[model samples]
Target: MAFSPLVDQLLDALRVLPGVGPKTAQRMAMHLLERDRDGGRQLARVLMQAAEDVGYCQRCRTLTEQPLCELCESPRREDRLLCIVESPGDMLAIEEAGGFRGRYFVLHGHLSPLDGIGPDDLGLDALDAVMEQAGVDEVILATNPTVEGEATAHYLAQQLKPRGVTLSRLAYGVPMGGELEYVDGGTLSRAFMGRQPFND
Candidate 1:
């Protein structure tokens, strides 16, 4: 029995998402065909719309529909305190914990020289511009606990040290090599609360 081209194409497209293996993709294709035409159409429409409309914030580099993300646009947020995170999801996690009242800067990725990522690739220039324009007094490096995250944090610390802003790193409550998105809300909140100044 041969599967139709459309079915095979749907399965292949679904597999592009992380953790969606061939089996899961096939199952999803079958399920969409068997039980969910309206839902599938809505899903496709929303995915296309989001892909076309969502873009990175000019200030923080977080995904946003507007020129700047909500965090950057908010006037109530503490502009003097900035938290540097690897991705928008990490920013969301910290926001959800409700412990951080400061602004955020999303790097979009960690420094991984083996994978060809570098400081310039992570929008450090924009970050520097933001710091200069906003008169940021403190920068909290809230990147994940992974090796690359640590490396990125250290690199940023070194570069920004002479800029005269107080630099701090998130506390060690987050397990080593763990991602910010996967850590529990309590742990993330505690990490923010216990953050220490990075003198080096």
Candidate 2:
């Protein structure tokens, strides 16, 4: 059966979201049209407002409504310690984990030469400027465990080498509760390589 042009367009638009297939998009469109049109309207308004007003933080490159993000504006955060992450999502995850009081520099993406995403695209020049202006002493590379993430971390390490700033990459290893038997080979190797002496 064919849906109306408007309904079809909505479904198509919804399908553009990651992991949203045609069936899921259709269901979402139907639910919005039938069950909660008012909520849909509100969602549209909020989405439009956010799209228009939300922008990257001037200092951290993370999404924000103001010139500087809250973290950047906070006086309590450690200014010398800068954590570099591939996205605001990663920064948020680290924040949720707590105990990290340092400032952050969101790359907004990883380096992918094949995809034409270079250092400029990742805003590394801006990062360099921030490091100089903030007098950053330590930079923690918290990019993901993926291949691209590793490459990005290495590239950053080289780029910042001349700056004399301390550089470190986040350790990758088996999950706390994961069993060695079920762990993948790469993860097992990483765990063994990154192992630290157990505290008595």
Candidate 3:
């Protein structure tokens, strides 16, 4: 089961990635060593470069090499509406969906007291500073629909309440093409609670 020490090290390193098990890591390491050393070299170079260069955007806390991210620097984005998300990936998903013209604040993570993460760790002070001076009118809670995400959003709402900005949470409901019967109970309940009146 053991190859060379370097190959074992490569497999272990590959396993550090999310969802990459021992077998997958072994296959990847083997493929790199046996098939495409050039591709592996390119991957290593790019990975090292990105790891060394990529840092948090000062304005939004999302991953960026610069002091601010492209979204934060965009003149066309709506400064009045601020969308708060839990991670850079979430921000990217919202951006890709389009139509939203607001700025974003990435928390990088959610509240989990058991894990020792709190408001300070999430950079709530920076967000508080933003709300105080950014002239923002609306703050959208776009955190994921989970216990931790909800707790983080609620904590943010409490903290930002004094700032006087209108706070809103993203709507949770059944998908447009999904049947109600197939929808889970929690989703159905949330949809029911957030239902709107029919128009004339």
lDDT of each: 0.90, 0.92, 0.91
lDDT of 1 by residue, 41-100 (tens): 999999999999999999988999899887788899888999999998999999998989
Candidate no. 3 TM-score: 0.95
Estimate the TM-score of every prediction: 0.85, 0.95, 0.95
The candidate 1 region of ten consecutive residues with least summed lDDT is 169-178
Q: lDDT per residue, candidate 3, 1-200, as tens digits?
A: 69988888999999989999999998999899999999999999999999999999888899998989988888998889999999999999998999899899999999999999988998787887777767899999999999999999999999888878899998898889999999999999989998999999
Candidate 2: regions farther than 4 A off: none
Q: Model 1 Cα displacement at 100 (Å)?
A: 0.7
**Root-mean-square deviation of every model:** 6.5, 1.2, 1.4
lDDT of 2 by residue, 161-194 (tens): 9999899887789888877899999999988998
Residue 156 shift from truth in candidate 1, angstroms: 0.4
| lDDT at position 188, candidate 1 | 89
Give candidate 3 misplaced runs (Cα > 4 Å): none
